[model samples]
Structure formats: C-alpha cells, structure tokens
Target chain A: MPQHPPPRPGDERTPGRAYSARFHLLDRQIVTEDGTPLAKADDLELIPDSDGSLVVSAVLIGPTALAPRLRGRPARLLNALARRLTTGPTDHHARIAMGHIIRIGAALTATTPPVDATLHPLEDWIRDNVIAPLPGSGHAPG
Target chain B: MRLADLMGARVIDVTGRDIGHVSDVRLTEAAAPSRRLPGLHVAGIVIATRRRSRLLAYDHRPVDAPWPLTALARRATRHALWAPWTAVTAHRRPPRTGEPGTVTLDQTAASLTPLRDMHAHWNSGT
Candidate 1:
C-alpha cells in the first residue's frame, strides 16, 4: 500500500452544513418566490472551480436532465424521445441558476419566474396547438 | 459537467486499487463571490465498496426510528469512505466506450476517513 500523509484534524468536515445530494436535492420540487411550482430538480449542473473542485452551478429540470440518471436501456430510449421532441440542441435542458435560488429547504425557492420559454416547451406547444383549438378550452373550470 | 456523470464513477487510489464506486455527493453552503445567495460547493463524495441502492444517510445521521431498519442501514454502510475533495487528484473520463469513468485520489484508501465518523464533526455547529 502506498503511504500517504495523515489528514489534519477536522479535515474531513466541510466549512458549512453538510448535505447529501441524493437525499437533500435530487427529486425535490422547485418553486418560485410566490410559491408557484416550477419543476422537480431532476439533476444538477456542476462547474469546476479555479482549484478544479466541482460546484453546483444550477438545478437542471425536465426529461433531458432526468434521462441520464435513469441509466441503461430506459435512459437511452427517454433521451432519444426527448431529443426528437426538442427543437433545440440535443443537450438542451431547462436550468435555474444557483444565483436565482433563494432557499433550499423542503423545496427550492427561486426569485426567477417560472414562465421562461425554455422551461416547458412541450406544455406550451400542447396549450397552443392542441388545447387552444378544442371547443370551450378558453373558459376556466367553474 | 453534470453531477450525473460522476454519480457511479469508479474511485481508485494512488496504487490503482479499486476502492469503491461513487455513492453520493456531499455539498456544503459556502459564501459566493458577487452574489447574495450562498453557493453549494462540492465538499466530497461517499464511496461504497459494494453495489447498493440509495444510502438513506442512516450511517451519517442520528436517525434511529424503526430501530431494526436503522441498524441494517448502519451496518451496510460501515465500510463506506469519505474522500474529501482535496484528496481527489484527477477525474478521468473513460477513453473507450462502455467503460466507467475513474476518480483518482492522491491518498491511499486506508488513509481516508470513515463516513460514519464524520457525523459528529458535521453536526457540531461547524
């Protein structure tokens, strides 16, 4: 076995409160400041720091972000389907920047609105192309 | 890069010994430059020698409800190691298709701290 320097006291601990990504972050709901549900945090976007340490850059949303985590054959199928549905590039996934996040409790709260065009393209397409053409689709439910 | 890419990557020590696979990533809230909101920094990763589903974090937390289940979870993760981000020397993407990526560490596997031992320090208001 290769000999290595011993870890200093408290070196194993983080400077701030520790959170396990799988337990605390993944699959959590993300909502806007006014409590409007935006999306589930399907995945995380990591960016390398100056020291090459990875940092969570953004919360990734939608099927494109989620498919990879599924792994194997199902993941490939979902990825292919999502690619065909999207008009953007193959890697396109809706993101909410960390700067916009205000809290990360039971649900992530963001200052940014949930109405971005890229946020839910499929839903928007359905609302316009399919729902709008239906009779009485314009009226709110009583 | 995405966290998904690193989730199941193989972890190897300086001697090229297969220690374990990346089980869960640990994050900490840190002061961000030019931003009011704190950024979530990658603190380290938890590596498990055996293939297992989600850890449920019983190994690192004081959760003891349903004693039997908690005991099992704690036993299952006893050998898990916590490799600090600083110890990570390189992250090599697989050169060929169908191979898992590798996370190389500067230290030996024996030198790393046990994941369970970290609970006290992390919960001590640090």
Candidate 2:
C-alpha cells in the first residue's frame, strides 16, 4: 500500500512571494476532525521532544490563551470575555492534535472531532433559544 | 442578487428590521489544492461595529463606517446555509433607517428572521 504523506499546512499567499507560519496560522479558526469549527489557532504549542527539538504538537484555542497575546485594552477585554464565556480556559487550552489536520488550503482543515463547539452551554443557549428559534434557523435562502 | 448588485442593497434582519449598512464580504473557503485559487472560501461575514464610540470615530461622516452588530448576527447562517454558490459568503446591506426599527417575525422573512436582544434577560457579564 502506498504510504500517505503527513498533512500539509494550508496555503500562504501575500501580494508577493509565499511564506507561512505564525502570522498565517495565528488567530485563524481551527476546523474539527469532522469539518466543524472547533476554534481558532489562538496560539501554537511548541513541545520539545527527547532530542530537545521543538515541534508543534497542537493548536491552543479559546480566549484565555489568546488574551495575553492581544496586548493592552484588547487583552483585558478578551480576558474578561473569556472568563465569562467559558468555565475558565482549560488547563491546556483546547488542544487539536496535529495528526488530525486533514490538509491546509485557504484555511486549515482537520478530520478530528470537535473538542470545542456548539456543545458549550453559551453556544447551545444562543443556538437554541436565540438562533434556532428564529424564523429560518439553519436554512439557506432559495 | 449579484454580490456587486447587493453592494448597496438595503439589508434587514429576518424580521426585516434595520440594523446598519454592509461594509465588506468575507470569503471563508480554503484555497484550491491542485490549482491556486487565490485562496477562495466563503467563511463568514464580519459586520462592523455601530457602538457610540464607532459612530464618534466616524465623526458623523460615512468614512468607512463600521457595520452594526445586529446585522451581523443574522449572517450566522452563511456557513450553515451551504447554498450552491459560495462566491459571496455574506452580504452587507446597511439598514435604511438609523435605529433598529420595528420588524415582525414571520413567514414573510423566508429564511431571514429578525435578530432579537438575546442578552435581554441575562446579565451581559460585563
């Protein structure tokens, strides 16, 4: 059987030459293993293996992880919002194992199931009582 | 409607209520793999802010004025909608009137519904 290659990071395009990394990945939404929106790539986790070489193990998401990087007032506001929205950021931030990533294109895609999603109480409340209750909750215009 | 045509089209909530004007369209799909597509995807639309600060920032002028949040909430359906076309993820149609105005929620709205104050009963957590 032919061996499949490791996932490729999504495309990176600018007005000029193509380059990729933090700027392209940071703050971008992370897709679920099942193609759902898990969350954004709030930050990158660089874990050093036994050899002392650091490799990206996962994508850290949620406001708590992001607030510190926002700076100044935005950070303060994001921190407060994160505290209100979640049960405080999880100890490790919502982690999406790099293996789950399916491919990279315009945005990152993953085959991993959603760790963070509509399951949240706040999201559920909004979708059910607020979003779903609306006229055409999840339907497209004809 | 053609996205270009809807550029200045008057946008309203599902209930046909006014919120604000359209600012920009957000494309959210990943770029094509084999062939470069200039990174095409219709992810979601970002509506500009209409807060008092934003208004003051505009200084009562239409200087790239941000959109109203109420209008943005309606577009939560763009991704879920999954229509035949993804060229335009969402449209920004600034409401005709200044205030949210009155809109009755019903079948007349097709797939659109008026965005309500979801935070009314709960503490804003602010």
Candidate 3:
C-alpha cells in the first residue's frame, strides 16, 4: 500500500529526486492521485542531469521501449499487440513526466492526469467480446 | 487483485520469458476441511490454457485468482511466495506493445531473482 498524505499544495522535496524503491519496484503500477492507470516503466530512461551526473529522467514505456529489448516470440506478440491497439498517432505509450511523479517508492505514486488514452484496443475488444458477455461486465457488481 | 483471477487468463512468465496461458491453479494447502477463511493455500500453478480459449472450459469451474506466474521463477521456497489480494497486480497490454498480462505478487513479486532455468529460446533473458 503506497499510502501517503497528499503534498500540502506546494511541497518541493518529493518530486525530481531519483530513488529506487528496490528491484521489485519495476513494473509496479503507476497510479494517479485519483487512482488511474498510467504506463509502467517498461525500462528506465537514464540520462545525465544538467549537472553532468547520471540521473534517471523518465521511465520509458510503450512497445517501442519494451519490444526492442525483447525478442523472438515475445517480440512478435508485442508487435502484433501494438499494431492492434494503435488508435491515433500510434506512439503507443503515454509518457509520464518525472516532475509529475510524486513518489518513486513502493507502487509508483504519481499525479499525472489521464491521457484520455484509448490505447488498448485489445483490452477494449476483450471487454466487448469476451468480458462483456460474462454476466457482470455492464456493472461493477461490487 | 485476487488469486481468484488466474482461472482463464494468459500468463507471461517474466523470468523464463515464455508466455504460458494459465491452465490450472495448484494450491499448496487445500481448504482446511474446517476453516474456509483463508480458504486454500497456493502451490505451483499449472499453465493449461493453450492458444485456444475453449480449453479453459476443460477444468472444473475456474477460480478467478491472482496469477502468481512471477513467483515460480524466483529464488525462494516456492511455498512462501503466494500472493494475497493486495499482491494481485493487474496489468493491461501496454498501449504501445498491446501485450495483455498481469502479475500476481505478494509484496515481493517483482524482486525475485530471475531463475536460470531456461536454455535460450525459452528464456527471454531480460
């Protein structure tokens, strides 16, 4: 549980500092303050800061970041998936600015707004074809 | 966010890098004849679901449990690495990659040492 008190409007210490929550930290869900689905750190994008010291700027996501790093069957599957879900400019990933990142420990805690992203055509397709027919798709049921 | 989810889902073995569609869930401890609170203890899960979705109906009623495929390759007593509700990490296929996968982890799913079991094609070697 990444339970943290909200920043008091203008706190400066939480953002822009780099910290690793631990190795288990990778692939953790980065949720917004309102608890929305954000992209995963498919890989970390590390670049030296303005001070010339190596720093992790933003966590790279989307197929472009993950697919090249992966190969063979997984690669084919990823490419097909990316092709199926692309609804727009087809960048495939919504990048979260490091500045919007409120915390970097536990589950990635951030405060970015929804991209209004309709990226997962497969997920939406499943919701329509497979999940929707499963009795409770129209309702939250809980 | 529940172990009850592995029933009919496709699972990506992050360690071995092979995608095994979930077939069956094997629990370590069965419903303790008397106590059904915790219900069942998780054991090794069987990936029975091949590419076809019809195969999912072959078993008894599939339980919607969290998919614990991540723990299978880690360096630990397979007995200790079961996921609770909060441990169930739901993932959608990335919009960019369009891969559909979710990870069932307790507090420690992502940190497990990648098991060196695969030869070459089997392990993506990430």
Candidate 4:
C-alpha cells in the first residue's frame, strides 16, 4: 500500500487547482490509457485517515458497489445476484487505485488496463458465449 | 460509507442543536503521487438550511451566466454553508431504538463559512 500524504496546509480548495469529486468524478466513465471503455465509477472506496478525515482510497467499479444506487426491484435483484455469485472474502468490487489514474476530465483515464475477471463478469460471459461465436463479431467495424 | 449516505445525513452541533441536512460534500484535489495527475480528498460538508432547497452549482463552483439566472440561483441557495471537516468530530449510526442518526460537529453550526464566501475563496485562490 502507498503511504498516505499528510493534509495540506490551509484550505484544501485552491482556486484553479482543486477538483470536486461529486462534480468531476462521480458517475464518470472509466477508460483505459488508450481510451477503451472499462467501467463507470460506480462508487468510491474510502478508508478513514488516522486524523479522522476519510480519504478516498480507490474508485469502485462493479454492481456490488453500485447496488445501493439502483432502484427498488433492480436493487433487490442485483443484491440477490451479487450475494449468489460472490463466493468468498476475496470476491469484492474491482477497485482502481488513485495512483493508477492518469487523468480526470470528462472521463477518468487509467494508466493500467483493467484486471481481467475483476469487474465485468457479465460482459465477459456474453462476449465469450454469445457475441464471440457470431461470424462477424471477430472484426472491428470497417 | 458511500457519498449517498453522507449527502442527506442530518447534522448537529456539539451542543446538540440541529444544524441542517448535508446537501453535498465539499471536495478538493489531493496532492497526486505524480505530477499533473488528480486525486481527491473530502474538505468539508455543505449543509443546506432547508431540506427542500437543495443547492446545486451555486455553492461549490462559480456560475457565470445570464444575469437573471445567476441572481435567481444565488438567492435560492443563499442559506447553504460549508463546514470544514475539522469541525466534524463524530458520526452516529441509526439508533436501535428507532431515532434518526446524525453527524456531529465540534463547534456551533453558526460559525461555518457561508457558501458564497467559500465560492469567493475558491475563486480567489485563498
């Protein structure tokens, strides 16, 4: 784990410098360094600082992290599915550490490719079983 | 906890007087481990005086707009204030006995920086 930086002197907000997580990061799409879509920032993982403030540790990307934001029936179904699929303590939402993030403009760009099998089980399953078998699916759009 | 959990949480001062509901969290970019990259840290919580009047773009960022819209938005969200995280001393979970939970601040709520002033400070680089 990377060492946490101490709090800055004076106010945290610096004009022309500070970025608001709610306005800039929340609900933004996560993309690879080369711009391939990976996932959305479903939620943020926070670890309590020794000083009592909460520090954002990672960007959470998965239905397990997103279930709280889903509406009534969808929330129930997703929660049930998540519970059924998650097998052990190791099964957790994929988290991209802040250190890996390259930029945070309209979309968040990460220096590293997303870990395979971390957050996109459904997408992987569909591609492998459904789409990959289709005759034209192997080629990119001309 | 999630940002959603904090957004609408009730806020109370050290004296146990109700302040308001948390309308939004005030965040600032933390020093990124690398040059030119951005990381975020929570700076404070924005308290909205009335539950219904949820302040939006007015409190955190400067909104340069057509005169009428700017005036209306500023007037509407005037009661919002940004209380520094230092004032936040504790968080309470919902009571097993059925009372609503609240976030506790160390000082009186009236001393918080008003949103208008925070916006000015945000823009002025102070």
Question: TM-scores for all candidates?
Answer: 0.84, 0.37, 0.37, 0.75
Fnat for candidate 4 (0 to 1): 0.32
Evaluate model 3: give its TM-score.
Answer: 0.37
CA shift of A112, model 1, Å: 1.4
Ranking by lDDT: 1, 4, 3, 2
Q: Rank the candidates by DockQ, best first.
A: 1, 4, 3, 2
* Tens-digit per-residue lDDT, A20-79, candidate 3: 212323466666675565667655443322322223345555665455345347866876
Instruction: Flag the better candidate by lDDT, 1 or 4.
Output: 1
lDDT, candidate 2, A1-142, per-residue tens = 2122333433322222221233345566566434455567765554433322223456565656566554347766876776776643344355566555545544566666554452244565566677777887679452
- Listed models, DockQ each: 0.38, 0.01, 0.03, 0.30
Q: Model 2, retained fraction of real contacts? A: 0.00
For candidate 1, give the lDDT: 0.76
Taking chain A of model 2 alone, its TM-score versus the true chain A equals 0.60
Q: Report residue A118 deviation for candidate 2 (angstroms).
A: 8.1
Per-chain TM-score (chain B), model 1: 0.81
Q: Where does candidate 1 stray beyond 4 Å? A: A1-15, A140-142, B33-38, B64-66, B93-100
- Kindly report the docking quality category of candidate 1: acceptable
Candidate 1 vs candidate 3, lDDT winner:
1
CAPRI quality of model 4: acceptable
lDDT of 2 at B120: 28
